[model samples]
Target: MTALHSSAVTDGDGDGDGDDNGRRRELRVATLVAACCLALVAVAFVPAPVGAGDNIASFWFNPEDTEAAAGDTLELELVASTHGDLVGDGVDELAATLEYNSEIFTVTAIEHERMLADGDSAVEIHEHEEIDEDSGAVTIEQEREPSGDGARTTGPMATVTFEVASDAPSGNETIEITDAEAILISDYPQGTFDRDAHVQIDGSAAAGASDADGVPGFTGIAALGVLAALALAAVVKRRD
Candidate 1:
């Protein structure tokens, strides 16, 4: 027969006092075990998004790519569209580093959208730095209105402007943003997402090189010059 450890019976001092104490200990243990089981059952019934792993929000840009000519300026906007339950601690701050092809564009300026400040009673701080040592990169940081009494968790956050280099050549270049972090007013940090941007260079010298001729502009002109010089040389040779 297997030994029984159940609280059904126990050897006490053969006195009622010892029996009562042993019974009390067994009752407490049973209560604790029952309470743990109930708690676990409650958690198991929780619904979508609230499911432990799916609770999260994200931040990204709209119109991830842009087309502009040399000397032209363009804007990129950032937005937050929560994916799961649309539940979040509400965003309070954002800090990021943006980079681009220095030879193709220059960081002109940036500003926070008013949408991020609609009901915030606290003052918002907006700051940005152009990394002069690295002409192709800029660092931006913004502290939105504080959480309580009206904080925003979504919508346009900011606009970054880039001026195409006056001498930029044709083709595509990447506008990279890194170390991006969005902090909620509740002090929680959003940890998962991706953001990207690309610039398509056109016009200016690139235009002078493509739109001028039925053929590729610059190459056609160079080819014509060479053929003309050859024809001239042939005429001179025949006369000799």
Candidate 2:
């Protein structure tokens, strides 16, 4: 009877130990799950970085949105911004192409701005401007002659003069930067962004409104559809 009792006591102790081990394993699993959840939540609250680099250079028209009358002449300033920090390099060269409705407007002239010169006339700037009337495209290229450290400022790269057609109808027209690129003083390619400009012509009668299909130019509704589709495609592509 004594030996039997001793065996039963040992079995009881073994069962107790097994139960304690199971409870410890459960606690460890719970702790690990909680830690993972907290880490995910913290990441969700963090803001996304704008760009990989310290500086995010961008190009856009001075007056992003403006109005012009038929037969009017206006100047559009193509501005570049280099959000340069202590560690970021500056812009030394730039190239861009502007697209517009050929029938509605014409490119008269284009001149370089002082931004590339760093506001110093002693700094020479080489500029080239070409107008393609057939396609309504204006190509602009500018470089600092002696691109040392580059200009770390924001200002106009070129001032484009446009002549509105005599009989342009009242509507919204988009001036888009189809292509653009920039180079830093380090000779490495710099990240850049471009924005489109909008010009609203105020006139009751249509001046040069006709597409190749022999129909009227893009109405506000048509333009909105195209713009929305383009924006959506861009977003989707970037996401991919």
Candidate 3:
């Protein structure tokens, strides 16, 4: 009877151990599942870097080469582009000025173009002018404020018509954007304009639409972010 009792005790201990091990395994599995869920949530909600692009922006007059007879009227475009991505989201305001030779040309008119960004709905604009004759500087300031909804990344900024002076010099001259003493007003704490953006640009004989080259590997990353969200959703559905 003692031997039988001992056998029974041994069996009971073995059974208890088996049960405990089973519970541990179940707990480990639960922990793993929970970790995976948290990963998915993070993937779905985490915001990607605001601009996965070069963040490079250029504002310049189009048709870099433009020419006309003295005293003739000349029309030109001022365009702004974000090389790879749309403008940053935090930006709510923008202001830029074009500085040129007041002795060579006189400002005739300034007009707003389509939205600067591709999908932007509304951008309020303010056009201001200052002509310094003694210094031979003509400043045309264009201010843009995005609506609460947001602004697009790139597009035509304005149309500037100039009346050339009858006695203007007969040679190519610059229609420059202010960057040194005066600056390009852009938000994100108002970044200064790049000389590189306009480095290749020059006022030409018949100004044709042109663009400054954008640095590669700096394209907008909106697509990557969207993919991350979609991957998270797929993982969640697979869990079921």
lDDT of the candidates, in the order given: 0.66, 0.81, 0.56
Model 1: per-residue Cα lDDT over 1-240, one tens digit each? 998675444455444676778889999999999999999988898754533223444556776887888888888886654332235345556666777777777767777665446466455655555564257777767666454432444666678777887767778888776777766555666564657787688858655755454654767789999999999999999999
Model 3 Cα shift for residue 177 (angstroms): 0.7
- For model 3, the superposed segments whose C-alpha errors exceed 4 Å read 1-54, 83-90, 114-123, 138-146, 180-187, 190-240
The total of clashing pairs for model 1 equals 0
State the lDDT of candidate 2 residue by residue for 59-98, as single tens digits. 9998999999988997899998885534555667888999
lDDT rank order: 2, 1, 3
Pick out the ten consecutive residues of candidate 2 with the lowest summed lDDT: 4-13
- In model 1, the Cα lDDT at residue 239 comes to 100
Residue 11 deviation, candidate 1, in Å?
A: 39
- TM-score of each model, paired residue for residue: 0.57, 0.65, 0.48
Instruction: Name model 1 segments beyond 4 Å from true.
Output: 1-43, 46-54, 82-88, 118-123, 126-130, 133-135, 149-152, 206-240
- lDDT for each residue of candidate 3 in 1-240, tens digit (9 for 90 to 100): 455433233335566676667778999999999999999999999977653322455666676665577668888777665433344342333456566667667777777665433444555655565656556455545544543433435666677787777655456667776641211233343333533122112244333222323554344566678889999999999998
Where's the lowest-lDDT run of ten residues in candidate 3? Answer: 194-203
RMSD to the true structure for each prediction, in A, is 13.8, 14.3, 23.0
Question: What local lDDT score does residue 207 receive in model 3, on the 0 to 100 scale?
Answer: 30
Local error of candidate 1 at residue 197 (angstroms): 1.4
